[model samples]
Target: MLHPALLDRLCKTYDGRKILDDISVSLAPGSINALLGPNGAGKTTLIGCLLGLLVPDSGAVRIWGENADKLSPETRCRIGFVPQTMTGLTWFRVQELKDYLSAFRNQPDGAEDRRWADWAALDPKARISTLSGGERQRLAIVLALRFSPDLIILDEPVASLDPMARHDFIALLSETVQRRETTALISSHIISDLERICDRFLVMKKGRLIGDLSAEVFAGEIRRLAIWPDTALGLEVLADLPDGSVWVRGWRPELDARNLPVLAGDMEAYFLALTR
Candidate 1:
């Protein structure tokens, strides 16, 4: 209801293969949402459909109550995107690249320091081509966030980053998006990272939207229950609790719930259960 950009019954096919089949979702503004799936689950294709980059076989993707394919130039400029792989930044210095991107904007940008310059901790004077992968990715993120776009679509932006860089990127993203009230639609296979940051979860499996859960539902409705070690429990019990319930048995023998009964505190178990 919060100004949702809707994708209604989207279907796509390439060579008779349904990459996205009847996928539908509503993305709300001013929140961080995760589009999570494994390889070939159509995350990128779905993003393409949402951005109007690919024409779907049927259905519609609307942004701000208008079709995504027909968004005004102003509306287009207000959307920031960071692809899984970067290009173009390699040819210019960091500062030059920043300046180049800024010139295209018709309106004044949001706060410079808060947008990215301060926390990204990159040398603007460094040659982008010579920078390390982490540094390059950081710079790319800075560019994507520099203009304070209304909607941000990041496609596996952190998959190639190092551990420290990943942590830094997550922190930087959290700070900037929350402060600027940006709506982020992030696609990533990293469950741990997504679990830590995203307020809502949208799960796709085999080109279908299998799950949608709000942050409140995640915290209140889902639960992690443990079974006693000595007592025998089977997967049969999990079939009765909930639709997406996951049960682990004989994994850990020391915890209060040694059998790890119907754990749902994290998204990993649930996601694995659903996708498998």
Candidate 2:
């Protein structure tokens, strides 16, 4: 079966610096995947290449087995994107903007459109320019999701939202994706929030894809061990640690025969270990 999205040996550079280097990954259908990395880790660059907004210097992007750069209107319509920042369209009122966008899809502004707007608690008469950051983000999400696209890509989507709004939005997204079996790709620094919905994790650093693993496997395999600071024995033990194991400064009474401590198996810790 074809993947919902695929990047094959994708690379991009800017101003003599490599922004994405030899990155390749596939997004499975009906799954919510999380992209995790610090600033300048090439997360946005990778998303741009995948969406065909920015051309890659090398490699290819394919969506549903078709070239991303040359997707048909029908194929394009099946993809929804919520960018990190909502810009432009500030001159239009909420309802007018919705009508304008709906016209492009040949869809009438009707009950469904109003339903989404109501869910977002967006006022029809309010101008976009006057909306708060969280409200603008909500508007963007409502627009992206109203069409019920087969695939959704969200970049830092919850960055501007408050705690309650963020929780509600995530819950809504989770329900929608599961009910429709839609594929989703979310990039965010909010690790705990992502952990609640994501089944897979992708880690990047210095424009390179450092780690990719299923949440189950990541929890089972990646581990944090505690070791004493003063002992040459601890240093010796560190040398024989399994590849990818991370050690911390502490002690555990329940060491295995090889002196390996029990696994901490934290998502944030795993991400930090890979990026570090």
What TM-score does each of the candidates earn? 0.82, 0.86
Error of 1 at 44 (Å): 0.6
RMSD list, candidates in order: 5.6, 5.0
How many pairs of residues collide in model 2? 0
User: For model 1, how does the per-residue alpha-carbon lDDT over 1-276 read when each residue is reduced to its tens digit?
Assistant: 535478999999999898998988877778889998878899999999788788999998998787988988888888888888777658788888878877887534557545477656788788888888777777777788777778899998898888887887788788767887788999988889988889899988888887788766666555445542234533222212244344432233334454444454578776776677
Which residue pairs come into collision in candidate 1?
none
Per-residue C-alpha lDDT of model 2 across residues 32-125, encoded as one tens digit per residue? 9999999999999999888888999999999998888888888888898999989999999988998788776746336545556666898889
Query: Candidate 2: which stretches are off by over 4 Å?
Result: 106-115, 228-260, 263-265
List ranges where model 1 is wrong by over 4 Å.
1-4, 106-110, 113-115, 224-265
